[model samples]
Target: MRHTRRRLTWRGTAFLVGAFAAACTLVNVVPHGTILERPFVVEGPVGETLDLSYAELTVTEVRTADTLESSFEQAVAGGTFLVVDATWRATDGYIVFAGAEVIDAEGRSFWATSRGGCAKGTNSQPGYAWRATYCFDVPRDALAGATLRLARGTHGEDDAGQRRDAVAVVDLGIGQHDVNELWDATEKISIEMPGFASAPATDAGGEG
Candidate 1:
């Protein structure tokens, strides 16, 4: 009986030691294992140029709208539309500026409009400047402290770890007064296709 008790106590002690080692391993491994892979986001504001490796991007203007001109019928935004006019100058080879989104202060992201006279994406070659408009359908509250993000590759490609590229984050700079006015204002805006030095305000509208 004594021998049996000793054997059981030894087994219990061994099990306890194993459990303690496992707990220590979990405490050490969980933190490093759960570390998130954050994106390398570079920030800028409107009118400021960002050199995003493959291209140079400058957000010229940001407009809010309830209606869009070209697709006037189905182009109406549910909440409100955020239109961004940007100029791109490619530095390397022909670079395609595809990924775009508007990030709010609360870390909510809204993608650019795929409809209503807006270019789905823009591409430019070296030594040439191109202008395009990206429209995002966002809620009224998203207007305040919003930022426009542009990237060289698509979100999928970035996630696949295929390309480690630079992303341009431009602030919309919508103040409280501007937000109030934008929410109340109903305007029809036209988005232009990508072109060389094309003025978005006067450019011929394309069916988005």
Candidate 2:
């Protein structure tokens, strides 16, 4: 009887220790969330007349839900948006004679109308680029497949500003997870300058 009791006690202690170890391992390996606090570059083509150059973009406040409307609401309440703080370097094939605009998927629009020079101490060139922030409002009746777009335009004393558009869409179902999951999805989105030609390669690489 005494031997049996001792064996049971030892087995119980070992089982508890194994369970604790498993739980600790699981916590360490779990995917919690992502933070894009540093600036990153996203480059692609926009149209024939311009080579879109956009970098130093940051995103924050990601929320998820079963429906687009719900997720958008949460994102808005949490101040979710995209911020672009870089320059648009004109390529040899294109000339940036005007400013740019940001158009959303739902036809909402924002403008970036300034031609400034890049500071000497930064990883930017002495060219022209627009700086702005685009706030995506939670649609009142957004469907599950709702999406948002960011467009750049050339508008000044030049030809009627040509608009080059690029889009980034999010699935509402993916946003329904916890905040961490929503953030992960947002970070995975790729923002490119559609239709524009690629800029002359620059060796301006640094930690963001």
Candidate 3:
């Protein structure tokens, strides 16, 4: 009976050790980066509309310039001004989009500049689509492989407000060749104020 009890004790110890090893293996092997609370990113290119659960987002166009012009204000960029045209159609009630960032290929993020009458974020309702332009002052290296991310949450705290929400990500489709041409551009782009959706109209605007 003594020998039988000793064998049982050893078996129990071995079972616990095996269970711990399996747990450790799972912790190391599982993809921890893909957390369950992460945002659901809807990706697309320019001219394509993406349904982001809360609203419909589209990046209409992207242009580069050295200066930005509005009706009463003018602003210049030390690097280059990237004018992004976008439209949003709200699905639910009133929504305010505060998350807007231009993320480059090398993981560099540039925030929108409202200095040139560009919009930082947008507020819209569910009736129709409204357009806004977001301008980013970015270096030449950030033009290529850049994507625009928009969400209702603020850009602060590592997009903490956007967690577990649907965020829209649109590629600007810029290449290295395009970067040089854009960087050399000396043209001034006209900035428009935020307004409702117009006929056959799409939007562009962010703060400032």
Positional deviation of residue 91's Cα in model 2 after best superposition, in angstroms = 2.6
Q: Best candidate per TM-score, number?
A: 3
**Comparing 2 and 3 by lDDT, which wins?**
3
Please give, for residues 39-129, the per-residue lDDT of candidate 2 as tens digits: 1213332221223343221122223222122211322222223323233333333332233333443544434311121111122223333
Highest lDDT: give the candidate number: 3
For candidate 1, the TM-score is 0.73
Residue-wise lDDT of candidate 3 within 149-204, one digit each (tens)? 99988767667778788998898999877888989999999999877655232344
lDDT of 1 at 64: 83
> Using Cα atoms with residue i matched to residue i, what is each candidate's TM-score against the true structure?
0.73, 0.26, 0.80
Better of 1 and 3 by TM-score: 3
Query: Which ranking of candidates, highest TM-score first?
Result: 3, 1, 2
Candidate 2 lDDT (Cα, whole model)? Answer: 0.30
User: In candidate 1, residue 164 scores what lDDT?
Assistant: 45
| lDDT per residue as tens, model 1, 48-150 | 7787767778888888888876634348889888888888878899877778888898878787877888865788777666888888898988888888778
